[model samples]
Target: MSKERAQRRAEREREAAVLAAAKAAEAERHERREARRRAVASRLPKKRRGPSGVLADRRRTQTRLLVLAFLVLNVLVWLASGDWAVRILALVLTALVGPLVHILMTKN
Candidate 1:
């Protein structure tokens, strides 16, 4: 019958419209996710040290500064503190454990 064919055509049109809307929504969501990823990536700090050589250089520079600051602080402490026990303790610690703890404690 003509009415039956019309009903089937209408049903197919509705299904096609639903499928098209779903596809459009999925594409929009994908685009939104990509834009968000780009936004987050833009906020990150740029890595300056590419390859192994630059990284080694950075480590060496930091280590050298740490050692220099430690030595300077130790000399100042040795000159300032008058208590014999404290001075003796400093000397003993310097001889036994080296400058790392002394440097860390000097901040407090």
Candidate 2:
């Protein structure tokens, strides 16, 4: 009876070891498959934006430059005249003119 019990315990240990080895092998295969996928993706070329995106980018840059120029002009107005009301009015107009022109130009 003692010999039979020893044999059964040994068999259970062997089965558990086999199961652990299978789990390890499956995880290694998954890692290798992921590596292969990343390598293939790296070899593909990146896609670029279309013409509409280019046009939108150009409009963005133009609007940014217009705002920068308006700020500079506002500073110049304040430096030259030094009046609170005049400076405030110039600043408001400077801020409004760019978007107004953009609206007018893009109106359909």
Candidate 3:
């Protein structure tokens, strides 16, 4: 009976040691991951001024191009179709909706 109790106690101690080691290892891994995340976050730019300005300029240029295209298409539709009602509707639709479409599709 004494020997059996000692063997059980030894087994229990071994399991506890293994659980403690695993917990310590998991904590170390978490600390390392957090350190790496902080390092990467620090390296990235916090504020973007130059790129945003350039992008805005490009968007303005693209918007102007879309407006031009919409105008040319409207004129073409009028000239080719030669129907007053169709031309009026097309012009109104293009003038009203073209800018909105341009803005929606624009990417920064």
- Number of the top-ranking candidate, with TM-score as the measure: 3
What TM-score against the true fold does each predicted structure earn? 0.44, 0.45, 0.47
Q: Considering lDDT, which of the candidate structures 1 and 3 is the better prediction for this target?
A: 3
lDDT of each: 0.77, 0.84, 0.89
Model 3 residue 37 distance off true place after TM-score fit, in angstroms: 61
Which pairs of residues collide in candidate 2?
none
lDDT of 3 by residue, 1-108 (tens): 999999999999999999999999999999999999999999997976554587778887887889889989998998899789999999899978987888687944
For model 3, what is the alpha-carbon lDDT of residue 100? 83
RMSD of each: 10.4, 10.8, 11.1
Runs with alpha carbons beyond 4 Å of true place in candidate 3: 1-52
Tens-digit lDDT track of model 2 for 52-106: 7877777777768767777788889999986899999997886678679767655
* lDDT score of residue 94 within candidate 2: 67
Model 1, residue 63: C-alpha shift (Å) = 12
Q: Mark the regions of model 1 whose C-alpha exceeds 4 Å error after superposition.
A: 47-49, 52-108
Point out the worst 10-residue segment of candidate 2 by lDDT.
99-108
